[model samples]
Target: MTEIWQRPWWFTNSSKPLLQPTWSYLLDNHGSLLHSHLFSALFPAAAYFVICTWFSCLMLIGPSQWRVPRPQILAVGHRSPSERECVVHTLLLSLFFVLPAAVLQSVLRTHIELPSRAPTILELGMGLMASLLLFDTQYFVWHGLHHVCPGLYRSVHAKHHQDHSGLELPISLAHLLPWGLYGGPAYHDKHHKSHKWHLAPYFIHWDRLAGTLAP
Candidate 1:
């Protein structure tokens, strides 16, 4: 058996076709559509609108919960890059991490057999719902751990919180390196601290199953 890490980016285990490989195929196809939309005027405008809206919401809602006292933010940066630089660098690093994971998932799908019959629209909807729920659960658990533990938080998770303190961005494994190495506490810490509210991130189920969730 190939080590999970050693498996080719495209190789999924043969037995779990629907569960593992299907997700990649679906996401890749969906992403392709989204990419194509970038060439059209409407999509870019819509995307910008959505991004702006999201940022606005974060600024208004996230600060109350995610903001560390200015002193805490400054203290964490003692041996690291400035907050602005850290955010930019970590964001770039996260993109690098996510791109490969996405490619690997796509490669894994190539090893599986796709549905022989066209999936009914209902089946597609069900699959999407299931995937989303699973992802959220895993993300929440994984994120919670970056706060509950300190040693693991510092070495593998603190990188994200090194400068910033907040849950403005959607959390995911891709963001882990940034959060892990830099400082944000999976963004959950902010929510926990601010509102005592705990909601799951979108992709939490996978991390939980993979044993990568912090707590």
Candidate 2:
């Protein structure tokens, strides 16, 4: 039997075709179409629209009690955006940012040499941890700057604050308190209330070190 590392990363020893025949045919013959703006951008944009629309609809029609248990983060006398406004902004994000970025990334990916080796379980775990740490640090700094800089806050980050309700996922995972150094939805809800804190998404180390952890 061939060793695991000898095969491609996506393969098992069985060497089966993971993708559908239609997709494999397109990838073999019309590869550029998969990398085209139609597939890379428009498809993702449409998917985003569907997901956001579905989530919005659920939040609208679902019982309020089904939402995650957390204190409302809106300031006194502050009003949350209406459903229409949320829908508009979500659509705008998909069209302008998500679509363009997807196409750009597809173009760039063709130039990049992707990893072909199957990572060991330990390596996979280590890679995931490294990614989380790097992302947490990057976001911590970026989020802090957005708060301290008035113009940057207004132009870049203020739109994110528009939905201060912090009911994004609306799952009942509230009981799973922010443990394991991971910020649960409740922990993130705290950030919406106290914007200067809980800046990192995956790990709490940066927030603790920067003294930005919520009290």
Candidate 3:
């Protein structure tokens, strides 16, 4: 008898695959190895470049009205890394962390059981909310700890706060105004500016309960 981990979920145990035949055939051949390499590594890296490029272009050449109204957040006389520097750093990060992690996930894929059927709407919604909450909780804890511990802040988190090494933040168009409930771009921008509050990424309640929510 096949082990439970070797089979799909009970509801979707039908012979039909969730994916179309051509795609299913490809998955049967290469499976998670191809998926991880293509999606987890290459797709994300490619997306980062493309999205960052768009952001840079928009900020540099787009209408002045579209720019963030706040004064430049960098401290006086502080120099942010140049475009080339950011690109080099991103490449190194992708090579060392992203690619290796994807490869590792692919290698371990067989040990993990996944549902074969497409999720119901309710399941999808629940999963998204769960993911958001989990991410927010983890982010809040880690970020708060870094701020509270001077050594951790100086050694690791300082560069992230100072240099704004991540380009993903600027991709969100909602930077002009803070969301009432969710931690929108403006919420995250406030955190970047203050570096002492708004540590939670999705829910504002975490910061509120922790007394770290900024006005």
Candidate 4:
């Protein structure tokens, strides 16, 4: 069996995230579409489904004595987010990530040599860690900048902040890089309360480091 890289080739030590033999095979065969759907839609939907179900269960099973307050919104304005919008936006968002990676991989395949072998489990773990690091830094920086920049906040992010009442999976996970286990509503709810919690990639250290952590 071929070993996959710990991270995508580009993010890996190999410096060839795009130029790998496995990717060509993965993308060209029937398996490619399946992989694309899995990455772009199915897997994320699964997370959505699970999180929703979990919360539903909580509402159903949690102690009756425990009362939760109505969610409070920021000064920007308060409005319930649209579920339809979240799902549609999320699907399109997934495509953006999937398509670019595919195109880059295809383009690189013609010019560069393949990786020595698939990344081993350890290597893949390392790659995951590396990906998380990159995503978090970029996520926080991007989110922070948007918060500080009124034009950006008003134009693009305001739409995102509009729906603070419930968990909108697609919109919640629609970050430039938000496919991880952490990219769901529970963690993201903090952002809705105030732009102070839940920086991207689901990691707290960066927020804490930046002193933006509300905890």
TM per candidate: 0.39, 0.64, 0.63, 0.52
lDDT of 1 by residue, 1-215 (tens): 55766754344344444444555665566645534422233443445445645654565567465433432443433764565575465455545654455545554543334443334444566787678667676666676676677777777655654544344345634465443532233435544343223335443344445554455
TM-score of 2: 0.64
Model 2, 89-144: lDDT tens per residue? 88888878888877787666654332233344445567877886787788888888
Winner by TM-score: 2
Query: What stretches of model 2 exceed 4 Å from their correct place?
Result: 1-32, 43-47, 68-78, 112-137, 167-178
User: Best by lDDT, which number?
Assistant: 2
Which stretches of candidate 4 lie above 4 Å from their native place?
A: 1-70, 74-78, 91-112, 164-185
Worst 10 residues of 1 by lDDT: 34-43
Collision count of model 2: 0
Q: How far is candidate 2 from the true structure (C-alpha RMSD, Å)?
A: 5.5
Instruction: State candidate 4's TM-score.
Output: 0.52
lDDT scores in order = 0.49, 0.68, 0.64, 0.58
Identify the superior model by lDDT, candidate 2 or candidate 3.
Answer: 2
Root-mean-square deviation of every model: 14.2, 5.5, 8.1, 10.0
- The TM-score of predicted model 3 comes to 0.63
User: Candidate 3, residues 1-215: lDDT per residue as tens digits?
Assistant: 47656665533444554444655565677677644544555665566667766766665667665454442466678777665666676567667766676667655655443444445444555787788789789988988899899999878776566545222244453343356677665667678778777898767889999888996
85, model 1: CA deviation in Å?
3.8
Error of 2 at 151 (Å): 0.7
